[model samples]
Target: MPKLTFAADLQWRRRFARAAEGLALRFALEDARDLRDEPDGADDPDHVPLPVHRDDYDFDACTDMFFQDTDVLMLYNARFDGIEDPGGETNQQIGMGDLCTAAWFDPFGNVKTRDPHRGFRR
Candidate 1:
């Protein structure tokens, strides 16, 4: 991985700081104190879907579980690929498909994991 320049680092910091602002996140009751692996209603045959918006449930239990903290990722860069003077030392020959790890697919339907040897052989 190429070491990003100071400017690039600053840009990313700003981007993340921006994304963190006014971010409305959803959360269940924090009264449990421990973490848990709640099964999805659709996936769990025994799970009854929560009624629309409001239902009452007792908070007291043997709930010894905690959830992973929400991770905030801001996918932005001062320089990008596929254009003239895209900057950021993007040499796609040696298999660094993109400087970005967040763009799973591009507009042209090309995945970001393309390599010279990962395609059809003629």
Candidate 2:
């Protein structure tokens, strides 16, 4: 596994500091196993499909739905055993709810606002 160099760490810190302005920070843990095994709400009546562009939809649409109002900073624990394959592919999975929940709760206590003219208020 590779480690973040001092310069890289400093650069990330500077970028994070800048982005943190008027925003809250949150930390959540989701094991790759759990994500991989999560049910797709096939039998759940309350399940609502994520929004996507009507014409062309794909993984990017799912990502857009997930990070609608919030920015994501992913930190992978590649040093952990059994998480990566020889091809360097990871078993991690990210879904729309994760981003929505992060934005819903201002974990760092930053105020949230939404445009009144818009239908939804966050």
Candidate 3:
């Protein structure tokens, strides 16, 4: 199954956090409206997710994270950094509107420079 639980989030987030810390990259995390049933977000920080794909379009619109208030620090997908929904309609919604905010920075902490750090784009 696709990993979507808190355990998975911890693994991925910590990996990214470590690398960011190593580079001395500075950033702050905003509050998140997490979906997982937890006591609170402060005690359990929410992690940014890459492009998500939900196979079952018929049952749930699966725009599960659309309203999530947390701003993403960075989002790197191997290719086409876009969310995928089987039906195609939901993808359009996310693309056209409410695309989650992502904060990308270089080693010096410049956000979205024209040089495009590591050739990654917004």
Candidate 4:
């Protein structure tokens, strides 16, 4: 895996620094040995899905627990593969939520904001 640098700009950097001070990040790696095992939320009893790997580890729990500190801000970065649209070949979106983690803001931070779906206060 490549090194993913995490930082913020002048304004948000101060906010992030103030919020993340003295916080400890707990990292856990999920282990999977079987490649043909039943999935966790399989609705169909007859269908066995491919086994999950370390990459499938869900961070919701960690986020929920840590995000309770309402005074702090949690930033997460997500990347997806394949981009095919009349707009271009890349689709990058940033999501910012309130204390409830309900996306109060989600915009294309990396791309031009000429799109109709682009806005800062959605």
Candidate 5:
């Protein structure tokens, strides 16, 4: 796993900030382990702590702080967009096109064939 530098983190924050326009949602670059476990326990046996300049001990509690009573929550698995599995024989990985295809539907299962590149060209 590659560690994110401070510069990279700031860059990503800016990108997300731009993308989150009119969404009224707060963005955070949270660690995977912090989201998975409490402070006192080991989240996973294979977990290896990555070095980050800052630590947010209350990240889990603060994640939903911006949500209101009327807000509808929709979480997308962005990791699926570019994760490669080394254990697979073919070294399977998901592409941006695949993610776009998978998410080209409304909550009611209505297909929307809009090109993803029109908005975000990742």
Candidate 6:
């Protein structure tokens, strides 16, 4: 498991948290977007604890904070364009282009990145 990073959009966090909670997994969440957007003492009255706010921290901090015991699931786009269904070759249609989804990552560096602060590129 290599240390890989996946950037998940903020909207999906709640649903993910609920699902993980139900599955008896202790998941942690940091708002990366927030971290990116807000830098140098930018605090909202209703500031949520997100990655944007905590840019100083790295990947390990996120993993330790959220994915301590459970697997880390990051959301990403499933760009399966132009891939036709095998059984339905006659029907020509592109696959679902983009959507909020999750991917499981191992705890070790092999699964995810050891450097939490690194920007995710996908």
TM-score, every prediction: 0.20, 0.22, 0.20, 0.22, 0.20, 0.23
Regarding lDDT, does 5 or 6 come out ahead?
A: 6
Error of 5 at 69 (Å): 9.2
| Ten residues in sequence with the least summed lDDT for candidate 6 | 69-78
lDDT measured at residue 78 in model 4 versus the true structure, 0 to 100: 30
What ranges in model 4 sit over 4 Å off?
1-8, 21-23, 27-64, 67-78, 81-122
lDDT of 5 by residue, 1-119 (tens): 11211234544544444445324433332444444566643444554484433544555455545332211121233333223233333323321121121221222234343443454
**Global lDDT of each candidate:** 0.32, 0.35, 0.32, 0.33, 0.35, 0.37
lDDT of 2 by residue, 52-87 (tens): 345332434434454444323322343533332223
What TM-score, to 2 decimals, does candidate 1 have? 0.20
| Predicted model with the maximum TM-score | 6
lDDT of 1 by residue, 1-122 (tens): 21232335544544434433223222244422222234443345444464533323323331222212221111223343231122434433333344342321222343243342343322
Error of 2 at 103 (Å): 21
lDDT of 2: 0.35
Task: State which candidate has the highest lDDT.
Answer: 6
Instruction: Tell me the lDDT of candidate 4.
Output: 0.33
lDDT by residue for model 6 (1-118), tens: 1112234555444444433442342222335434536664347545446456445546456555644332112212133321223233322332322222433322344454445344
lDDT value for candidate 3? 0.32
Query: For model 3, which pairs clash?
Result: none
